[model samples]
Target: MSNYSRFSRRRFLTTAAASGIGAVFLKGCLGNPPEPVGTAVTEQVEAAEISPEMMPETTKVVLGYIPIVEAAPLIVAKEKGFFAKYGMTDVEISKQANWASARDNVTIGSEGGGIDGGQWQMPMPHLISEGIITNGNKVPMYLLAQLITQGNGIAIAGKNQGKGLGLDISNAAEFVKNYAKTEGRKFKAAHTFPNVNQDFWIRYWFAAGGVDPDKDIDLLAVPPPETVQGMRNGTMDAFSTGDPWPYRIIAEDIGFMAALTAEIWKFHPEEYLAIRADWVDKNPKATKALLKGLMEAQQWIDGVNNTEAVVSIVAGRNYFNVPEDILVPPYKGDYKMGDGKAEIKDKMMGPLYWKDGIGNVSYPYKSHDLWFLTESMRWGFHKDAISDIDTAKQIIDRVNREDLWKEAATEAGFTADIPASTSRGVEKFFDGKTFDPQNPEAYLNSLEIKNV
Candidate 1:
């Protein structure tokens, strides 16, 4: 084990002893907390045990997710015997290096053999839609379930940090423009993928600030866990990632959170439980079973007490590999990135169980996909890629298996009355102007920067 891990374990035990609380990972430099005297079972453990027969009888299913708190439901389901209760034994969960690795694993494992499903950053399927990555290799992917919704925050380090640095201002939008002009330096922020929620959020936030992210910011693809290290290493000035990292940074007093993704747009969607097309084709029944398990886990995690258990479980070394204190939500109904400075909240980020199944695995809303595509194009990831809006929509439609999700959700007891058609809801950012998802042409046209 690395020095960090050793230190963390020692710290974890000490904290537990004093508070009688379960262990929580507190990465990004927490010293230590008083030890609790006794071990305590999280509320999740106490939830009435589920029987193995309650779930479908499926063989082993290999699952992949990045090491982040958003993937907690999967862990909870597995650890708490939800998977076993549902008749799924030999369920394997592995942490991939990054989003690209996770997506590739889904494609290859689904095609070659038994890689059941993989969790993906919310915008990845959309990227395949815009023909942004690996052309023709973009296999049709399906959304079995929506995992966690909003879970990211924008973190800014001190001025002593390297490139992409911006001043702290209450009005995040104005801060970007003035920082760009006065600093005469391109601001940098790390995100796990160029086509994910954080990617879209950074671009949208900048746009709202009157500074075009496409023109002003240099966004890089860095995995979530590595972001703070990047900031500490002076390779990045700020970064946007979900959970723990920002809170971890603040707990250690390394930096301040500039904004939360929910601030950019309340009810913003983030990650999903995505599977490659072929996998869905081969194991359709298994897919439904997996969705049921996930839905149950989602509902469990949403309970206030269960949320506390989630923080403890995901913080373990086997999962997120961070100290538990770092994973705790800093505020009630909100998240603080740095020292409780900035907070954002929305209904979407909350737990979403089967609203009676039909609404379970809904298709990716056009607006949600568009924002990421626009960001990829805006930030230069889509160079020479398909620029036509119609083509983008087709790509999105092919991969987003909302229909499949509906079936699974219905089976899981989720509501089936979700609007059959996608909505072109206006994209509201902190700056106030709305980007209409339905009117992509006009939205793109209105932008001051080059679309291509």
Candidate 2:
């Protein structure tokens, strides 16, 4: 007998009414809500056809996620029954306090009251695998898939508005470079974490305009909420982070967006879905099941008419815990860039999951991993671990699990969506710099400002 079978209808109703959850109890008793139109029915059919042998090795796993737009697919998979559809009924999507807490938790593993794995910043899995960020305690992780593209940017405090702090800070590079001489301190900036995606974005923006990130400004790792408060108090000059934190900056009148990551590098890789390698090796079938659920959730979020539903689910109290209105604009690609800048209203310039301008957003491309490591080398981050291009390639080969993504895609009947190669080919940035996976050295040498 099931757990629900132990509850008599009369007793259940009485208890629910006493707790003021009568409506919720009735809804649960009626079964799941009706599926949406289009692909949902087909997805239901596919899930219904999953045989006994195809079931996952385990039904329970704890996953951690920060409350950013990048974590939408993980949240959607849990809320929309995607995980359950794949035989992962007890999957838990735990909310992480911040990136630091996430790192600390994953270091302990789920059995120790930490998470198995979930969303992560670029190259974190690789860094963790090599023990670069974990203080020499290597926690080998697999880069399962890319969670999102774009939906991030650099936000400037209101006081610095109209100081040429826009996307191209070339005209105002000297003003930023000379802050210490004039203001008696270096211009302050912050990112959510150090030497990762957010840090790289702000650093790239500064370096592109001839401002040395190391010498021209003071960049540090600060949490989003604290960063916002600092901006309001005129202590933080700028910050790099993902939505809806950046969106909140504009909504609350604290600052204006300097540049969207979309403009910096269109359809650039953002966060990812990665898991501990030990957990994955112990439960291979369960890993694939998790991928299939995430793939379905990604497709569901990419639907043209499902933006409102996406916002409603992710912005709930259990997830992002933010207002739906704040998330809606970015989902629609309707950015109201303040500081007298023109608005960006293109749908393609927002957060994308399954696919983007270059194609196959979910596929964990090895070339992308190489770029992150290469960027790390450029900044001399973890110089001893990621020594050179060859070392970076070796790390990419060891950590990037594109083969797993392919297998899961085939099992999920999404083979057609898979890319022909691991490399996305040559990538172009807004500053007219190109990174060809074939020759990363050339790209690094072409840069005007770099540590290496």
Q: Pick the candidate with the highest lDDT.
A: 2
Off by over 4 Å in 1: 1-58, 110-116, 126-132, 160-185, 224-226, 233-235, 330-334, 337-367, 374-385, 416-424
Model 2, 170: alpha-carbon shift in Å?
A: 0.5
Q: Write the per-residue lDDT of candidate 1 for residues 169-231, one digit (tens) a residue.
A: 334545555555865666677777765677766666556556666556677788655777767
Error of 1 at 159 (Å): 2.4
Cα deviation at 140, candidate 2, in Å, is 0.6
Model 2, span 1-452: residue lDDT tens: 43332323343223212211111101111122211111121122123235555656777787878889999998788767676666675677766767776777788887876778889998899998999988999999989999999999899999898899999999999999998897788999999889999999999999998899998899999988899999999899999999998788999999999999999999999999999999999888789889998999999999999999899878866567689999999998989889999999998999999989789999999989988998998998998989999999998888888999999899989998999999999999999999999999999999989999
On TM-score, the leading prediction is: 2
Model 1 lDDT-worst window of ten = 28-37
Clashes of each: 30, 0
The pairs that clash in candidate 2 are none
